[model samples]
Target: MKSELQVFQDYIRGRELRRTPERERILQEVFEIHGHFDVDGLYLQLRQKGVKVSKASIYRALPLFIDCGLVREVDFSEGHWHYEHIYGHSHHNHLRCLGCGDIREFENPALDHLEEQLAREYGYHIKGHHLQVEGYCPGCRQAGAFPAESNFLAKDSNDQ
Candidate 1:
């Protein structure tokens, strides 16, 4: 398998975009994060490391990374989007806890079968899919973490 830097460099060259140290630094920081992250948090992380990268540069590079299939955007119903590097990772879905805003990754062959069936039935070519099952986790349910009305309305800062 090709390294992330090699894949990114190939993509940049194909698109005729310059390969700058700043963009490479941003890419390194992005892949270093194991979990979900937003642009503002990424900016802070790079700044703390004394990397002189502007958030604007990060903003510009993100679309390129996504286009190259090196990164993907995930939404947890928060106001903003979070990103994760998908290179060298297997496909999976998310199980989100509404009460505590915790996210769990899960994989199942059944989902893959369903996608195949749907594609054949509809005669549509499927690229990929995102499935997020939302509910209270065991700990949250046992602790009664939700409000009286509904837990679905709960939104937290840690909703990744």
Candidate 2:
């Protein structure tokens, strides 16, 4: 696997931008996390490492990374967008907890079959699909984490 730095370097090269130490540093930090991070979070991490970079620089560089197909943008309903390294991986859907903000990745053959069947029935060719399920997680439910009439919530409400 190409290091994230190498990926970023290639991106800069393809864009005809001269490679700089600051760009390398930023890419290194982003690659190390390899998870969701917003612009402010990335800036804070770089600052913690004594890297003096402006927020605007990181923001501008992110789109370049995206354009280069080295990163992906994810919206987790947290009122902020996050980015992750794509690394030439196949697509997968996300399951998220609306209350706890926990995210899980899953692949379902049944869902795939359903999409294919629907496409065939409609006389259309399937190209791609994105499915996201968001709800309270089991732990959240057990803890009465959401405002609903779940069994745990009912028990607690009855006790009260």
Candidate 3:
């Protein structure tokens, strides 16, 4: 298996695009992240780590990163792109905290069987799926707003 940087470098070379150290550094930073991240958050993280890459450079390299299968874009209708590593990870679902914009990854093998059954029933071949369950985290949920008896609907910030 080729290293992600090597794969990306080869892709750029094959496309006749020049490779730069800045882009490679951006890829290095991105590949290191094990959690979901957006362009703004990644830019700040790199800067805080004393890396000198600009936000524009990170944004530009993201497409190439996605193209080379090093990253994937996840959307939850948040009006921006969130990315995570896909090169060496298995399929997973997301639990997104709507209040803090936090994301947690989880996987259930049973989903594969369920997906297969659904595919067969629909007479379609399953390629892939991205599932995001959005809700307020415990910290974001207002105390006493949602009683234990009716906890299915937790009062989020907007309900206040």
Query: Could you say which candidate leads in lDDT?
Result: 1
User: Which sections of candidate 2 miss by over 4 Å?
Assistant: 88-90, 109-129, 149-160
In model 1, residue pairs whose N, Cα or C atoms come closer than 3 Å (at least 3 residues apart or on different chains), thus clashing, are none
Question: Which pairs in model 2 have colliding backbones?
Answer: none
TM-score of each prediction: 0.90, 0.75, 0.75
lDDT of each: 0.91, 0.81, 0.84
lDDT of 1 at 116: 99
Candidate 1 on 2-87: residue-level lDDT in tens? 99999999999998989999888999999999998999999999999999888899999999999999999999998888888999
Overlapping backbone residue pairs in candidate 1 total: 0
Clashes of each: 0, 0, 0
lDDT of 1 at 157: 37
Tens-place lDDT per residue, model 2, 122-145, is 998887676779877889988988
Of 1 and 3, the candidate ahead on TM-score is 1
TM-score of 2: 0.75
Ranking of all candidate structures by their TM-score, best first: 1, 3, 2
